[model samples]
Target: MARFFGWLFLIFLLGATYFWQPDFFQHSYSILKHGDIVSLAEYLRSFGAWSIVVTIILFIVMTFTIVFPFMILSGAAGIIYGLFWGVVISWTGEVIGAVVMFIFARYFFRQIIAGWITKSKYLKQVDDYSAANGFKALLIARLLPLAPSGIITAVAAISRISFKDFMLATIFGKLPPVIIKVLIGHDIVFAGENMTRLIVLVIVVIGVYVGLWWYKRHKDQNKVKY
Candidate 1:
């Protein structure tokens, strides 16, 4: 009964969020056009209560095995909470979702390789490192968006990676991109022009290249069988 209401609530939330995307954009635009930074921040902060409510609501949805519900909620968080708290709430929801998926994979799908994943040599290498470095590899993977963080958690769990390392690495590695995305969203909220988008893209590209170069020199190659 409780699970049923959870699913029902998620369906309603997803519908409201997706079908109303334009509405959200217009609402944001209206707020930004008329309100200064302090007023905008206050208006957004007022929605913090709604954000927490939605996060909790999505937590229940995730526990019931609905992934789309969480993604929709993440976007809604960005739209409603205005990036900073959006990242915080979304990250919290995602980490919890990853932990749930980890547990589910361990208990239910221990031997299933799902063919798409089994064929990748790179993925195998990552899995091997995930075994040894446990959390650090998870953290790096989380930071880079090289792999889905949820998958990292599940693979780590199935491989019996240390929980302490997994949690710590997940938190540490996921922080950077979350921070970056929040800043990007904040800029979009304020920039009010297409030139800003172009500038932001260039900056992100440079950032990615630098990140890759840094990894090439600093990443530990010895831990993997490759």
Candidate 2:
């Protein structure tokens, strides 16, 4: 069943890339050339709603294997949906993708991943922290948005973490930054005097990373010795 889903996902993703690439480019161009600032903004606003829907679908399809696919789709979503709906859709999709990937990974790759990570010194802390504060570790990882979270989801699948905790942390941790990005996308799509939005986006992403790093370090230090 897992392999079948994996293969199915793989084939469709390839087809989407090959077939949809041209249409995507065209859509981007058409949106850009809608004439005048007012018209463009209106078009983007309309598109943003639809873009959120598309992004949600794509995110569900892509899962957590690679980040690029979602990023590209999010860019499109932002271009069309603007920042508000774009980010919302993109973020929602990402959370869904993370959840799906985590569940799948737990089913398919948990044991293998657990054994592999157990052997690595650097990953030892991650393993330890994940084992001790499984949900919190996953939450921090989700919040920080470091390392493709799909990996963390995979880890959580294997760990002893409860499904409820995993889902809760994943959803909550992902909310803030995802919302920020969606809004940023909204502003970018609008394309007017919004330097503050742009600056805030960069700062927020960076700050999230820093916070995640600090959290990980703290968690590692306070880790219960096995």
Cα-based lDDT for every prediction: 0.58, 0.64
- Candidate 2 on 23-88: residue-level lDDT in tens? 654553454344233333443355554745544655665564353423445555566655566676
TM-score of each: 0.54, 0.61
TM-score top scorer: 2
Model 2 stretches with alpha carbons more than 4 Å out: 1-53, 65-72, 82-84, 114-131, 145-147, 188-191, 210-226
lDDT of each residue in 70-128, candidate 1, tens digit only? 33344445656666777887677666766666665655554455343478887677656
Candidate 2 has a TM-score of 0.61
Show pairs that collide, candidate 2.
Answer: 48-81, 82-186, 83-182, 83-185, 83-186, 87-182
Q: Which stretches of candidate 1 lie over 4 Å from their true place?
A: 1-50, 56-75, 111-129, 145-147, 185-198, 209-226
Indicate which candidate wins on lDDT.
Answer: 2
